[model samples]
Target: MNFGERLRFLRNELDYSLRKMADELDISFSALGKYERNEHQPDFETLKKIADYFDVSIDWLLGRTQEGYDHAIRIIDNAVEKMDPNSEVELYIPPAILNEMILKNIDESHLSLIPVYGAANGMLNLSESNIIQYEFKHNQDMPEESFFYIISPDDSMKGSNIVKDSKVLCRSLDIVDKKNLEEGKIYLVSYQNSLYIRRVFVNNQDQITLQAENVHFPPILIHNMSDINIIGQVQSVEFNPNEQK
Candidate 1:
């Protein structure tokens, strides 16, 4: 069923009148009618409000999945109930494992996979490492080929919410031109064969300044930009550590 059909079904299931639903949602009756008729699509905020009111996941409202919020809650509850508090908990499970559990019966052609690199104690040569693949839903605007994952080496960027040992999703700068570099943005950089994550500052001269979020680590200045290798831009991070057993 489409979004409109689903919306109408939800309202009917709740036994709410059109006027009552509209008034409760703080939207015009005509707008609600338009949504039900599929004549006009509600904005993201409106859709979120509707999801909240119906106590359903947005995925269900958008017809992405038949399973509602209750199903999701049950899944969480089941997982929690199976956990042993005294045992070491596996915090970060790669998406591939989830796919094996949930998408094993689904067609493999529709699934998209991205490389996730495990952490290395020293400088990592991406070409030499064996990467674990994880299912990823890519944004249309993202350059998928340039995307890769790395683990944060230290807590230097903790002030910026990037904690140590966290997995970071990055986009390689090989695909991005030097002129497109934005100041005050975090990037995965290579200098003197060592990897570092720092906020970038480009000056009028040929120099580039790399600043650590932690004040304890002083700002690093590279006299020539050529000396600094732009590995990639840090996009997002996931922190999940195994607690003591």
Candidate 2:
């Protein structure tokens, strides 16, 4: 692909809109459009910025080499394949870094699958599931067995940049964990047999306030704490790379 075609492909690979990609590159929307259409070309600095932002080499962006962004990913994969898992010196890669690789369109076959589910009621015990498929087997402190995935259903938490359909990592909460809930933390909760994602505020032992990041959703005050079923504490939220910009 040519520069423009590659730029468009990388943007579309992550589902970035022209305006969003332009804003990220600090360029005007019209200029980005023109570049994509081959009507105009970005300056040297802008060209470099585009290449950096898309994680591709300038040579590749300019069509001088076929080596794509996945070139490094390939090297890492090959090294990992040859490395000994039982080596005395262990190699640990953080989940954030691994997630970045996943965001770069790493094959899912390399991912360590976790059960993904959707939030339903306070119990959230739906029979169906499609969990997060991140690279690492676990998220360090949070083991693989301790957490699962749930799809963020709406814009209620958009203020936190967690858009709808984002994969939410929820650590399973036990009674002890629920009692030790942290203030101002978002959680998956069940009340009135429905699920909710809201920032939690400790009121008293028997009461609490659930606040929505979006102003349109009014805060809910639960007088009886027992009625509020704390399902799990939200660890991390990941926007699907394929999500529409």
Candidate 3:
């Protein structure tokens, strides 16, 4: 794609608007509009800022090369292959974890699969105690089994879709990559010797701010250095009939 087309495409793919990009680049929206519309071009310094913002190279911006200067095109290509928007991906769930989830709730028939959409999003343990177990099996090593649970100590995520005492299920692999986090979606995260269930608000640089589904809970700042653990990406929610009328 040409410079304008590439800029527009990357901006749209990342869900950034002209105003936001302009603000970040310290330029006027009209200037950004000109660049996007091919009406004008940015100087070297401005071009550098744009390239840095998009993590691309100036050469890539000018269409001198098919790949960006960062040489991260391979990574992006791999990600695109794995994360095909048109395809439905299935997670490889182990049988042991499945049984544990059923027994943890004390209602085998009530157990259902929840689809989590974010990195830290997962099934939340709402039992009186943490009965959920993590079973790990590896080559030439005994499987490690441990039990843990998360709770939203604050009422930040009170109303909306995820409420207090909402039992959520999480996938084990969602936390590792930390790339598929969807903003405005609820997630179960482990931070500072505690487990919290909250919605994720991403600002930039893969750093996320945690917001409660309920306004009562104050928002938490999650830095990259924080020892946070994402147990699963929440896929779906299971509502128990007994809890309802």
Candidate 4:
């Protein structure tokens, strides 16, 4: 199920009558039905209200994860609350593609194509059991291990001019590269169980700090590097808010 399907599923499973829900949300019944039908996406405020009403994370509502309340509550209830969007941009990567690349560590002949993902979940490992589709967009010479893309989830990185729906380019890092992280550079990181796209700073004492380009989001400090995984350094981005895909 995609976002709309999941929304409907939740309403049915939880016995949230459409009329009741619509009234509670202060929206028309037809609008609520449209949301369930995937005909319209709720604005941020309405989206937040829906999440709060359903007690689910935005990621789960968007079908980013199969995890239930126990696991997803972390993203919403923890510190930096409402800060990270768990930007899971669903892609059409079929299982066959994962097997081809992961099992064989496919050679450079296949390097021209890399997967771009949403900044939703942690990127400790790339193979997601539920991901579908096998679409590939040619990217010349991008053979770096763990090279990937993320559709910008929000305007937190707007200070860097990276806005929502921006296609961000990035590549994972090795231990050496992680240790020698350049100060004042942006990185895609996994903190707790969620993914974050932020500017990174490493202190002489090995502490790490995650800063958002948009000042609205205060910089996050990590006393223990173990708490977060440095997914990769963001290389470039392309933006088009009206993007169909």
Candidate 5:
């Protein structure tokens, strides 16, 4: 069966009515029917919501693969929002899309869409997963990797330019190694399963103390050396509270 057919089958197997699924998905009931009948296709954003709701990968929804959903929590949870006023944004992706992209690296040149949350909309505190695709002309010094955006959750390290709602470019690094945790540099440290963007204050001691930029947040003291894992270091940050207004 095609992706659309499979989507319909799953919806039915779960004993969800068309309107119920539509309401949950923030889509019109007729639209859900259309997707089932293969009359139309969901955009990337909508597809992501559907995938998240079903706990399936986009690849699976697209009929790219025939594997049962395996729910594995990743490091960071990417979120998305729906445009509809009546529904909330859900996280869902098909396994097929992920698998295919893994096998054959996604061609970034074909897609250049960026997901921008309407920060102005107070009624809508929404997050959307936007995969932006772009191609640049040949240049002498091309960056090894483009900056991926991540929003900060704390104000500690404001002294070092980190604040809440700060969009940052984090250079991926191996933070687990003691040698990798350089002194005086800001790093996104994952201590005891929770992720924190802070400066490594005292890596010299057997216990590491992570200091926050803002005075309000308390310093994180990690006792077990084995529990600390560094995900990446903050290269730069951009703060714009005005957008939320």
Candidate 6:
């Protein structure tokens, strides 16, 4: 069941009227009705209150698990306890929880995209599981255009702070114009039918040089501007996994 249906079911099971429940929760009856109707979702704090009042887990309220609330909490607690404080692995949180948290905090306007990942010459493909929903409000002065999100496929750009698995917000360029290209700025470009996020530098001979932030990866030289397809400029990088919580 969805969150609204579950909420209503719990309320019905408790034999509480909408008005009474609203009064207890310190919210308006209309707001509670909106939540039940799925017209509006509760913020994290409100969700916590509902979960506590209903004696349920956040996962259960969000419909991520069918396990009883107490059991789910025990499982979550054990899993969290096993995590190392300095580990690089991302901690797992159910997608529903993350999605709701993001929706509640960001501007309603946003775009959802499957992040493409691969090297410059390798076959680029969209990740089936790494879909990201991002709101484009970081650079308000920039002109609006078609935007997409991509994940940095490797540590090639690690030196520039664009690490692996980082979500990059890009503005679509579609066409490549060497004259308009700025040197030392990172861009999402297509070369040899593969997508890449790399810093572009213009040479004196009009050649375009693609450089990796990491010195280990050698710079690629492109003599023909037509050989490179400019996908877009990288606008921002979102690296924090905790923000989704």
lDDT of each: 0.68, 0.67, 0.54, 0.64, 0.58, 0.67
Deviation in Å, model 1, residue 155 alpha carbon = 0.4
Model 6 off-target regions past 4 Å? 1-123, 126-145, 240-245
What RMSD, rounded to one decimal, does every model reach? 11.8, 10.4, 18.7, 18.8, 17.2, 13.6
Error of 6 at 33 (Å): 27
- Predicted model with the maximum TM-score: 1
223-245: candidate 4 lDDT, tens digit per residue: 88777877788887756564547
Candidate achieving higher lDDT, 1 or 3: 1
Write the residue-wise lDDT of candidate 2 on 1-245 in tens digits.
77788678778877889999888888999999988887887889988888778666677777787443464367356545644454332334455445455334454334443456654432344343322222243333545557777777776777776666777777777543346888889888888877788888877565688888887779898877678888888888765634658
Clashes of each: 0, 4, 28, 6, 30, 0
Candidate 2 segments exceeding 4 Å error: 1-112, 119-125, 129-141, 176-179, 204-206, 240-245
lDDT of 3 by residue, 74-96 (tens): 32333335433554543333444
Between candidates 4 and 5, the TM-score winner: 4
- In model 1, what is the error at residue 167, expressed in angstroms? 1.2
Report the lDDT tens digits of candidate 6 across residue range 106-147: 222232322333323333354433333322233334433466
How would you encode candidate 5's per-residue C-alpha lDDT over 1-245 as one tens digit per residue?
Answer: 68788788668756899899999999999989999999999899999999888766798789877443221122002212223334443333334443333333333342222222222221112234332211121222324253234565555666766555666656667655565568867876776656677778665567788887676888888877578877667776645463465
- Model 2 residue 195 CA deviation (Å) reads 1.2
Clashing pairs in 1: none
* Candidate 4 ranges beyond 4 A from true positions: 1-111, 119-140, 176-178, 204-206, 242-245
